[model samples]
Target: MNKRKIIDRTLLTDLAKDVGLNASHLEALGESCQWEIGVDGDMLERLVEIQHQFERLAVMGDDEYRGFYIEVPRPAPEEWGDAEELIASGEYDSREAFLADWLAFNPMETRWFHVASNRYGDSRSIRVTDRKHTHFIITNHSKCTDAEPDDTWCRENLTRLFDYLQRMIDVIVANPDGFNDYVAHNLPYQQRTGRIAQKEFNRIVPNCKIEVEDKETAIKALEDSVHGRSVPPLETMTIRQYCSYYRIANEAYEAYYRKRGASGRFYEDPQDVPEELRDVAYYKRIKFVDEEILYDIDSPEDFIRFATDHYGELGLSRLNIFASNKRQKGWMIIVSNSYSANVGLAIEVATALYKARAPLLIYDAEKLLRILLEEDYVRLVPDSYHNYMGYQEEGSVYELPWEYECSEDTDSVLNKEQYQAIISNAEWQPEEQAKPIA
Candidate 1:
């Protein structure tokens, strides 16, 4: 309705066509005239084209321009003589400086359109996150700001946002014990694990009293009490192996302790630990494997196998390992002999495809490769990247192969290309998976 509202390219282009004016002409006119634009006579026709182009350009995706970008240079005074006189002039060398001053003086005209239109299209994206919680938050730089608001205003807003986030983080940190207690009470699985662990622990460490604040000390005491009594020394069990034994001990304790007075092969009357310990269950289930294992594992089957094998020696049935590190989306796994090198490569790849927001997928490739090269699982030594077994190629753009067999359906799996496409075009609505090729 208003000629002044025609800011983006789509509306402008359409208006241009309707009024026998081209996009180039309207843009030229906009650059040449500071007069308040109004819908009248021939100008109305140009107004329509301007509005059309504005709408079209507003929705264009980021990658639609690829390598092409427009660099608008300031026009000489003689070229836009009339328009230049209408607007204030200053001793500014750069057009950006002039624009800054121009915007300071005129708020309404300055914030007309945040995005620009070019041959390829507009450059803006809308991002939503459910899968990429920590991943997105961590990757986000303080630099990026919204288009509609100026950078200084956006910075002020972000400062307030960050202050709020900091307060939230502080709140979470200050109440870890309470949070753990809540989880134990509210979460069924956590309650089960806690009860079982406490029962089993009591058998090994008789009259054990667990204070929430002394979790680490309690764990150490349990290990010390169990070593040379029911199980091997603290040194004998790797962290992973200890986790396996602890969980089995818990379950076994639960089985034996609930029916108190019953004799058990592992320990007698398994209620040696206080029942209060069961109120904070999550801490009792200590995992030996580093959080990194989540990135290395492929199928749920692989996770299960890893869990079973680690605990099997301790006569444990199955261990539950939560993959806390590897989240569901915005990340993909890459196996490499050198974790450091691969991490660097991942970052490079991420930057090359920044629009995609691909997170570095870490695996136990470094450890495994060292083991493979050494021909001994127990003894490993750091070696050069090329010396590792996973190093198949030496090129800059080398395609790293998966060490383990991946699922056949690649469509569901997040890859570089797919990630790039998604980030490059936020408006893209991926088609539902057609039936996989026969």
Candidate 2:
């Protein structure tokens, strides 16, 4: 890079000599610097496009979003007609005077969108994710841990979607030029591997050395990182892996109660979701207007709130469902509340009774346990992104696994207020109405 010629040569020479910087790294670093400086041909073209976008937006006035991103690493103040000579000559003495001039001259500073223009799709939000933003996070248990679950509900409308996915991945594999640019843009501000494409990024970029304690080890690791070519947290998923992802999202939409609503962000219009899969809202709504539905329970707390409101009582206990030979031994769940509650649970020994359809969530309860209960069971590293204290399974979280055990007296787990309240009442309405078992 031309910048390297003027940078501290002695320091560069020492680092290169010490680490034995290879030719590939040298070239990569040079290209990275060039991108930062706005020299790359594609980047230059993009800059022009961005400027045109700004001009077009400015002409539209306040009817729509008239504001635009002032390009990253904005041009010098002089470029915006702010002459520094005025300040140097004392023409602008106080901070107030300088800011007044800036606000009057800097279009980027003065520009803003109308309040009505703040609606969704009016302006783009910067997001860094590997998968398409659309997702169905929950699913039935079978699809949760299963890598390749059978596709049972391939509705005709979804054909366009699958075809689009196939075409998109084909482009990524054939030439990841756009993908590389996106990763490079967020490389500095994101994790060591950038926001997404993290595993794919590992193949080239060097690991960060900021937190390494041992000086020698840090240098050696950085040197090896750039030079050594290998895989590293999650490699780019193969077609099988991508299919499993599709399976989970797809099944979540179809499994269980087959409720009418969908993700709120895109619910406004099915047409907006280009390659239409299914009319998430319109299809099944009028089907069961009279049925008692678990309308909007998005989380455990929401479930607790609904149960408490409807049943007038809550309790807790254990339920273990055993499996056949060569299978997982059993699955255990914390269940129940105090006996007198009117709420009906489906299983015997459960509280709370519902006559109508209640939707089931497609979820990996095992993985979800690890995420939600991490404070209780997962050990923390003092200064790390991950909770595990050490590499692999060597940590307190793994060593002392936690499972909820019903109290001998109350048949409930304790600590949190909700859990505490569930067990406070010892009396229950009896198993017939209680619908509970351990």
Least well predicted 10-residue stretch by lDDT in candidate 1? 130-139
Off by over 4 Å in 1: 1-438
- Candidate 2 — which residues are off by over 4 angstroms? 1-73, 81-187, 191-362, 375-438
True-structure lDDT of candidate 2: 0.24
TM-score of 1: 0.15
- C-alpha displacement of 181 in model 2, angstroms? 18
Residue 401 in model 2: shift from native, Å? 34
| Deviation of model 1 at 66, angstroms | 12
Relative to the true structure, how large is the alpha-carbon lDDT of every model?
A: 0.27, 0.24
